[model samples]
Target: MKKTKLLLISLLLTDFVMLLQPENAWAGDVQITCDLRVLELTSQQRNQIRLRRQQYKTRQRQMNENLMNQNVTDRQLSLRHFFSKSAFDNQQADEIAKQRYANDVRQTVAELNFYHDIFQLLDNRQREIWLQQCVQPAGRI
Candidate 1:
């Protein structure tokens, strides 16, 4: 009787542990998304927010692409490759690229700031939702 009771208790404990495990049936399809559900926003305001978010993402992509392209060009220019034209022009090309890269950085920071300002409008509850969404890991496309 004692052994049987121990076995039953162990089985129940194992079942409880299994039940506590989180479900991920949807796995990659699961998105912890948050929208402007808490706020009263007009259609135009919603559209504007959507547009700004899109533009902000575009700026991030641009920043990454710009840096990568600049790196490739700098490497080629250092080696005086044909794509880099002449060794004489390499220095000027590098400086111009640096200036343009700085401008892109500034623009991206400005856009980020604009989004931050928008976030400031949220009440505590809305802010909590927004922060939760922000902290979530980026999902696979």
Candidate 2:
């Protein structure tokens, strides 16, 4: 009985660890598809682009964490005011919303720069291939 219980616990822990793995852990398909559609490049160019993509992803994750932290702080502040029975001002709320929107725009611009850098790294023919395979579908190329 003891051995069975221990085995079950071990299995549960393994399952939990697998569940906690990051979403991008399995990106083989995406890379393969990109390689097939994009123009031929030197292995070094491919590796460099892969490294840049990873860096961009890391920066994006950090940005998301910062945004979440900011949201939590704002929510806590609102809760504190509510507990104090403070009156909510519509104007103040509107200003906060505007500020958040402006921040979102700035973040979007930064993300665009990362994408533009990736596009710039691609040769003209590769860029065209990328557009046809990915971006042009959405008329976003």
Candidate 3:
């Protein structure tokens, strides 16, 4: 009985440790970018990707700032004190959706441009590596 209890406790502890381990799923741009390590990029290519990523981040920040400014204007126009909480939430959601929809095309163009720049930098072998090891495995290709 003691041996059985000890074996069960050990199995439970092993299971708990496994549960704490990080998952393999790379879900975001940042995680996908990290997976670029598998591409074996040259110094020049890495530098180019770094610069492109910086530019992308800057554009995204600017776009977000514009959206925020528009949201501020929208909030200023809405009389928050008059509406019930649910009504205020609905109005805020609508405004957010409008802002996102308005910027969707620009954001997509920027992102596609960024990826295109990165893709253009790769040679055939590197491109295959990128596609198979980085993009395909990430379920992004």
lDDT of each: 0.62, 0.65, 0.70
Candidate 1: TM-score? Answer: 0.36
Q: Estimate each model's TM-score.
A: 0.36, 0.52, 0.53
Task: Please list all clashing residue pairs in model 2, or write none if there are none.
Answer: none
How much RMSD separates candidate 1 from the native structure?
A: 16.4
Kindly indicate the candidate among 1 and 3 with the higher lDDT.
3
Candidate 1 has which clashing residue pairs, if any?
none
Q: lDDT per residue, candidate 3, 24-128, as tens digits?
A: 322223223437777788999999999999999999999889876675655544545435455457766676567556676577678778887898998999888
Task: Quote the positional error of residue 140 for candidate 3 in Å.
Answer: 8.2
lDDT by residue (18-112, candidate 2, tens digit) is: 66553323221122134433478768767877888798888878877877767667767865765565687777677656866775566666666
What tens-digit string does per-residue lDDT give for candidate 1 at 5-102? 99999999998886644332223223334556655555766777787778777877886776666666665665565345644676666876676558
Return the candidate ranking by TM-score, descending: 3, 2, 1
Determine which window of 10 residues in candidate 3 has minimal summed lDDT: 22-31
